[model samples]
Target: MVQEKQSDRQQRLDNFLQAVEAAQKVQDDIMKYGLEAAHLYCDDIDGDWLETWEEDEDGQQSFVELVTNFLQSDDLVAVKVRKQLKDKSLQEIAVNLEKCLSLSEEDDRIFAVKKVLLRGVAVAESNRGTSSDEIDEIELLDLAEELLDKLAEFLVSINR
Candidate 1:
Protein backbone atom coordinates (compact mmCIF):
# COMPACT_ATOMS: atom_id res chain seq x y z
CA MET A 1 0.00 0.00 0.00
CA VAL A 2 2.85 2.37 0.82
CA GLN A 3 4.53 1.63 -2.49
CA GLU A 4 1.29 2.22 -4.34
CA LYS A 5 0.83 5.53 -2.55
CA GLN A 6 4.39 6.54 -3.44
CA SER A 7 3.74 5.68 -7.08
CA ASP A 8 0.58 7.74 -7.09
CA ARG A 9 2.44 10.73 -5.66
CA GLN A 10 5.13 10.39 -8.29
CA GLN A 11 2.52 10.23 -11.00
CA ARG A 12 0.89 13.39 -9.72
CA LEU A 13 4.22 15.18 -9.64
CA ASP A 14 4.91 14.13 -13.20
CA ASN A 15 1.50 15.37 -14.27
CA PHE A 16 2.11 18.75 -12.58
CA LEU A 17 5.47 19.12 -14.29
CA GLN A 18 3.91 18.37 -17.66
CA ALA A 19 1.24 20.96 -17.04
CA VAL A 20 3.91 23.53 -16.17
CA GLU A 21 5.77 22.79 -19.35
CA ALA A 22 2.62 23.12 -21.40
CA ALA A 23 1.83 26.45 -19.73
CA GLN A 24 5.32 27.72 -20.46
CA LYS A 25 4.97 26.75 -24.10
CA VAL A 26 1.64 28.55 -24.31
CA GLN A 27 3.18 31.66 -22.73
CA ASP A 28 6.05 31.61 -25.21
CA ASP A 29 3.68 31.29 -28.12
CA ILE A 30 1.54 34.16 -26.86
CA MET A 31 4.57 36.41 -26.49
CA LYS A 32 5.73 35.65 -29.99
CA TYR A 33 2.35 36.34 -31.53
CA GLY A 34 1.88 39.53 -29.50
CA LEU A 35 5.24 40.87 -30.58
CA GLU A 36 4.38 40.33 -34.21
CA ALA A 37 1.17 42.27 -33.73
CA ALA A 38 3.03 45.09 -32.01
CA HIS A 39 5.58 45.26 -34.77
CA LEU A 40 2.81 45.54 -37.33
CA TYR A 41 1.05 48.19 -35.32
CA CYS A 42 4.28 50.09 -34.87
CA ASP A 43 4.95 49.94 -38.62
CA ASP A 44 1.53 51.39 -39.37
CA ILE A 45 1.17 53.77 -36.48
CA ASP A 46 3.86 55.83 -34.81
CA GLY A 47 6.71 53.68 -33.60
CA ASP A 48 7.47 56.50 -31.18
CA TRP A 49 4.05 56.07 -29.60
CA LEU A 50 4.84 52.49 -28.77
CA GLU A 51 8.32 53.43 -27.68
CA THR A 52 7.12 54.98 -24.46
CA TRP A 53 4.57 52.29 -23.96
CA GLU A 54 5.52 49.64 -21.38
CA GLU A 55 4.96 46.69 -23.66
CA ASP A 56 7.69 46.17 -26.18
CA GLU A 57 6.98 44.16 -29.29
CA ASP A 58 7.47 40.96 -27.34
CA GLY A 59 5.64 41.96 -24.18
CA GLN A 60 2.73 43.34 -26.13
CA GLN A 61 2.60 40.17 -28.12
CA SER A 62 2.51 38.03 -25.02
CA PHE A 63 -0.12 40.18 -23.37
CA VAL A 64 -2.33 40.29 -26.42
CA GLU A 65 -2.06 36.57 -27.00
CA LEU A 66 -2.66 35.69 -23.38
CA VAL A 67 -5.69 37.94 -23.28
CA THR A 68 -7.03 36.61 -26.54
CA ASN A 69 -6.62 33.01 -25.50
CA PHE A 70 -8.03 33.68 -22.07
CA LEU A 71 -11.06 35.32 -23.59
CA GLN A 72 -11.71 32.50 -26.01
CA SER A 73 -11.21 29.72 -23.50
CA ASP A 74 -13.63 28.38 -20.89
CA ASP A 75 -12.09 30.72 -18.33
CA LEU A 76 -13.19 33.84 -20.22
CA VAL A 77 -15.97 34.97 -17.93
CA ALA A 78 -14.05 34.09 -14.80
CA VAL A 79 -11.15 36.29 -15.86
CA LYS A 80 -13.51 39.25 -16.06
CA VAL A 81 -14.81 38.65 -12.59
CA ARG A 82 -11.26 38.59 -11.34
CA LYS A 83 -10.55 41.96 -12.94
CA GLN A 84 -13.65 43.53 -11.44
CA LEU A 85 -12.60 42.34 -8.04
CA LYS A 86 -9.18 43.85 -8.54
CA ASP A 87 -10.66 47.07 -9.85
CA LYS A 88 -13.02 47.35 -6.93
CA SER A 89 -10.05 47.94 -4.70
CA LEU A 90 -9.27 51.13 -6.64
CA GLN A 91 -12.74 52.65 -6.40
CA GLU A 92 -11.67 55.75 -4.50
CA ILE A 93 -9.15 56.94 -7.06
CA ALA A 94 -11.36 56.05 -10.01
CA VAL A 95 -14.13 58.28 -8.75
CA ASN A 96 -11.99 61.33 -9.50
CA LEU A 97 -11.31 60.65 -13.18
CA GLU A 98 -13.02 62.95 -15.72
CA LYS A 99 -14.04 60.45 -18.35
CA CYS A 100 -17.61 59.28 -18.65
CA LEU A 101 -17.75 55.81 -17.22
CA SER A 102 -20.21 52.92 -17.09
CA LEU A 103 -20.18 49.65 -15.22
CA SER A 104 -20.50 46.41 -17.10
CA GLU A 105 -20.45 42.74 -16.27
CA GLU A 106 -19.35 42.41 -19.89
CA ASP A 107 -16.39 40.28 -20.88
CA ASP A 108 -14.63 43.14 -22.67
CA ARG A 109 -14.35 45.36 -19.60
CA ILE A 110 -13.00 42.54 -17.51
CA PHE A 111 -10.47 41.76 -20.19
CA ALA A 112 -9.42 45.38 -20.41
CA VAL A 113 -9.03 45.61 -16.65
CA LYS A 114 -6.89 42.49 -16.58
CA LYS A 115 -4.66 43.85 -19.31
CA VAL A 116 -4.21 47.12 -17.51
CA LEU A 117 -3.44 45.44 -14.22
CA LEU A 118 -1.02 43.02 -15.84
CA ARG A 119 0.73 45.82 -17.65
CA GLY A 120 1.02 47.76 -14.43
CA VAL A 121 2.49 44.81 -12.57
CA ALA A 122 4.82 43.98 -15.42
CA VAL A 123 6.06 47.53 -15.54
CA ALA A 124 6.43 47.75 -11.80
CA GLU A 125 8.22 44.45 -11.37
CA SER A 126 10.42 44.42 -14.46
CA ASN A 127 10.51 48.07 -15.44
CA ARG A 128 10.42 46.86 -19.04
CA GLY A 129 7.69 45.78 -21.34
CA THR A 130 9.41 43.00 -23.21
CA SER A 131 11.17 41.31 -20.34
CA SER A 132 12.08 41.88 -16.73
CA ASP A 133 15.45 43.14 -15.39
CA GLU A 134 16.38 44.60 -18.78
CA ILE A 135 15.26 48.16 -18.18
CA ASP A 136 16.92 51.15 -16.53
CA GLU A 137 15.45 53.13 -13.65
CA ILE A 138 14.10 55.97 -15.80
CA GLU A 139 12.47 53.60 -18.23
CA LEU A 140 10.88 51.58 -15.46
CA LEU A 141 9.48 54.66 -13.79
CA ASP A 142 8.02 55.88 -17.04
CA LEU A 143 6.41 52.54 -17.72
CA ALA A 144 4.98 52.41 -14.22
CA GLU A 145 3.46 55.85 -14.64
CA GLU A 146 1.89 54.89 -17.92
CA LEU A 147 0.50 51.71 -16.40
CA LEU A 148 -0.96 53.62 -13.47
CA ASP A 149 -2.65 56.01 -15.85
CA LYS A 150 -4.19 53.14 -17.74
CA LEU A 151 -5.27 51.44 -14.53
CA ALA A 152 -7.00 54.59 -13.45
CA GLU A 153 -8.74 54.85 -16.77
CA PHE A 154 -9.91 51.26 -16.58
CA LEU A 155 -11.23 51.68 -13.09
CA VAL A 156 -13.09 54.84 -13.99
CA SER A 157 -14.69 53.15 -16.96
CA ILE A 158 -15.87 50.24 -14.89
CA ASN A 159 -17.19 52.38 -12.06
CA ARG A 160 -19.64 54.11 -14.30
Candidate 2:
Protein backbone atom coordinates (compact mmCIF):
# COMPACT_ATOMS: atom_id res chain seq x y z
CA MET A 1 0.00 0.00 0.00
CA VAL A 2 2.79 2.37 0.91
CA GLN A 3 4.61 1.63 -2.31
CA GLU A 4 1.47 2.17 -4.33
CA LYS A 5 0.87 5.48 -2.61
CA GLN A 6 4.40 6.64 -3.32
CA SER A 7 4.10 5.66 -6.93
CA ASP A 8 0.85 7.58 -7.28
CA ARG A 9 2.45 10.67 -5.77
CA GLN A 10 5.40 10.41 -8.14
CA GLN A 11 3.10 10.08 -11.13
CA ARG A 12 1.08 13.09 -10.05
CA LEU A 13 4.28 15.09 -9.63
CA ASP A 14 5.46 14.21 -13.09
CA ASN A 15 2.14 15.16 -14.60
CA PHE A 16 2.01 18.44 -12.66
CA LEU A 17 5.49 19.37 -13.79
CA GLN A 18 4.63 18.60 -17.39
CA ALA A 19 1.52 20.80 -17.18
CA VAL A 20 3.47 23.68 -15.60
CA GLU A 21 6.00 23.45 -18.39
CA ALA A 22 3.17 23.47 -20.91
CA ALA A 23 1.59 26.50 -19.21
CA GLN A 24 4.92 28.29 -19.16
CA LYS A 25 5.35 27.62 -22.84
CA VAL A 26 1.90 29.03 -23.48
CA GLN A 27 2.85 32.23 -21.63
CA ASP A 28 6.16 32.57 -23.40
CA ASP A 29 4.53 32.08 -26.76
CA ILE A 30 2.07 34.90 -26.10
CA MET A 31 4.85 37.19 -24.96
CA LYS A 32 7.03 36.38 -27.95
CA TYR A 33 4.46 36.10 -30.72
CA GLY A 34 1.85 38.64 -29.62
CA LEU A 35 -1.84 38.02 -28.99
CA GLU A 36 -2.68 38.26 -32.68
CA ALA A 37 -1.06 34.91 -33.22
CA ALA A 38 -3.23 33.49 -30.51
CA HIS A 39 -5.66 32.21 -33.11
CA LEU A 40 -2.81 30.41 -34.81
CA TYR A 41 -2.03 28.94 -31.41
CA CYS A 42 -5.60 27.58 -31.25
CA ASP A 43 -6.37 29.31 -27.92
CA ASP A 44 -3.05 28.50 -26.30
CA ILE A 45 -2.69 31.69 -24.24
CA ASP A 46 -0.68 33.38 -27.01
CA GLY A 47 0.61 30.67 -29.34
CA ASP A 48 3.22 28.77 -27.45
CA TRP A 49 1.32 25.53 -27.20
CA LEU A 50 0.59 25.35 -30.90
CA GLU A 51 4.26 25.93 -31.66
CA THR A 52 5.37 23.36 -29.14
CA TRP A 53 2.90 20.79 -30.41
CA GLU A 54 4.00 21.41 -33.95
CA GLU A 55 7.75 21.53 -33.33
CA ASP A 56 8.21 19.23 -30.38
CA GLU A 57 7.57 15.58 -31.20
CA ASP A 58 9.27 14.20 -28.11
CA GLY A 59 5.92 12.68 -27.14
CA GLN A 60 3.21 15.09 -28.28
CA GLN A 61 2.73 14.15 -31.89
CA SER A 62 1.21 10.83 -31.03
CA PHE A 63 -1.50 12.71 -29.18
CA VAL A 64 -2.06 15.40 -31.76
CA GLU A 65 -5.82 14.92 -31.84
CA LEU A 66 -6.09 15.06 -28.08
CA VAL A 67 -3.96 18.16 -27.69
CA THR A 68 -5.71 19.96 -30.49
CA ASN A 69 -9.10 19.31 -29.01
CA PHE A 70 -7.93 20.48 -25.62
CA LEU A 71 -6.43 23.67 -27.03
CA GLN A 72 -9.35 24.56 -29.26
CA SER A 73 -11.97 23.88 -26.63
CA ASP A 74 -10.02 25.94 -24.11
CA ASP A 75 -9.60 28.78 -26.56
CA LEU A 76 -13.27 28.85 -27.40
CA VAL A 77 -14.10 29.05 -23.73
CA ALA A 78 -11.63 31.86 -23.24
CA VAL A 79 -13.23 33.89 -25.98
CA LYS A 80 -16.63 33.60 -24.38
CA VAL A 81 -15.34 34.43 -20.93
CA ARG A 82 -13.64 37.53 -22.25
CA LYS A 83 -16.93 38.76 -23.64
CA GLN A 84 -18.89 38.10 -20.44
CA LEU A 85 -16.55 40.05 -18.20
CA LYS A 86 -17.10 43.25 -20.16
CA ASP A 87 -19.75 44.55 -17.73
CA LYS A 88 -19.23 42.63 -14.53
CA SER A 89 -18.47 44.32 -11.22
CA LEU A 90 -15.26 43.47 -9.37
CA GLN A 91 -16.95 40.80 -7.27
CA GLU A 92 -19.04 39.44 -10.13
CA ILE A 93 -15.98 39.37 -12.36
CA ALA A 94 -14.24 36.99 -10.01
CA VAL A 95 -17.25 34.67 -9.99
CA ASN A 96 -17.54 34.75 -13.77
CA LEU A 97 -13.89 33.89 -14.13
CA GLU A 98 -14.27 30.92 -11.87
CA LYS A 99 -16.79 29.58 -14.35
CA CYS A 100 -14.02 29.45 -16.92
CA LEU A 101 -11.91 26.84 -15.15
CA SER A 102 -13.76 23.85 -16.57
CA LEU A 103 -11.38 24.01 -19.50
CA SER A 104 -8.30 23.65 -17.32
CA GLU A 105 -9.73 20.63 -15.64
CA GLU A 106 -10.74 19.34 -19.03
CA ASP A 107 -7.21 19.79 -20.32
CA ASP A 108 -5.72 18.02 -17.33
CA ARG A 109 -8.17 15.14 -17.45
CA ILE A 110 -7.70 14.63 -21.16
CA PHE A 111 -3.95 14.45 -20.69
CA ALA A 112 -4.37 12.10 -17.76
CA VAL A 113 -6.70 9.86 -19.73
CA LYS A 114 -4.21 9.69 -22.56
CA LYS A 115 -1.44 8.84 -20.16
CA VAL A 116 -3.52 6.20 -18.48
CA LEU A 117 -4.48 4.64 -21.78
CA LEU A 118 -0.85 4.42 -22.81
CA ARG A 119 0.91 3.71 -19.53
CA GLY A 120 -1.78 2.13 -17.35
CA VAL A 121 -1.49 4.92 -14.83
CA ALA A 122 -3.43 8.14 -14.31
CA VAL A 123 -1.01 10.85 -13.19
CA ALA A 124 -2.86 14.08 -13.77
CA GLU A 125 -4.35 15.80 -10.75
CA SER A 126 -8.03 16.52 -11.29
CA ASN A 127 -8.32 20.21 -10.41
CA ARG A 128 -10.93 22.72 -11.53
CA GLY A 129 -11.60 26.43 -10.88
CA THR A 130 -12.58 29.64 -12.70
CA SER A 131 -10.72 32.91 -13.32
CA SER A 132 -11.27 36.58 -14.21
CA ASP A 133 -11.18 37.77 -17.82
CA GLU A 134 -8.95 40.25 -19.72
CA ILE A 135 -6.05 39.28 -17.48
CA ASP A 136 -2.85 40.69 -19.00
CA GLU A 137 0.28 38.71 -19.83
CA ILE A 138 1.96 39.29 -16.46
CA GLU A 139 -1.20 38.37 -14.61
CA LEU A 140 -1.57 35.24 -16.68
CA LEU A 141 1.99 34.25 -15.92
CA ASP A 142 1.48 34.88 -12.22
CA LEU A 143 -1.67 32.77 -12.25
CA ALA A 144 0.21 29.97 -13.95
CA GLU A 145 2.91 30.09 -11.30
CA GLU A 146 0.29 30.15 -8.59
CA LEU A 147 -1.29 27.02 -10.04
CA LEU A 148 2.07 25.30 -10.23
CA ASP A 149 2.71 26.07 -6.58
CA LYS A 150 -0.69 24.77 -5.57
CA LEU A 151 -0.23 21.57 -7.53
CA ALA A 152 3.19 21.03 -5.99
CA GLU A 153 1.67 21.36 -2.55
CA PHE A 154 -0.95 18.75 -3.46
CA LEU A 155 1.83 16.46 -4.58
CA VAL A 156 3.63 16.88 -1.27
CA SER A 157 0.57 16.02 0.73
CA ILE A 158 -0.16 12.97 -1.40
CA ASN A 159 3.40 11.79 -0.94
CA ARG A 160 2.85 11.56 2.79
Model 2, 34-114: lDDT tens digits are 876576556556546655664334543322333323223445433333332333333343332233333457455344322
Q: Which lDDT tens digits does candidate 1 get at residues 60-157?
A: 43233333333334553424423423433333223321111233433444444434445445645543346544535454344334434454444454
Which residues of candidate 1, in runs, are more than 4 Å off? Answer: 35-160
In terms of lDDT, which candidate is strongest?
A: 1
- Candidate 2 ranges with C-alpha deviation above 4 Å: 43-160
lDDT of each: 0.45, 0.43
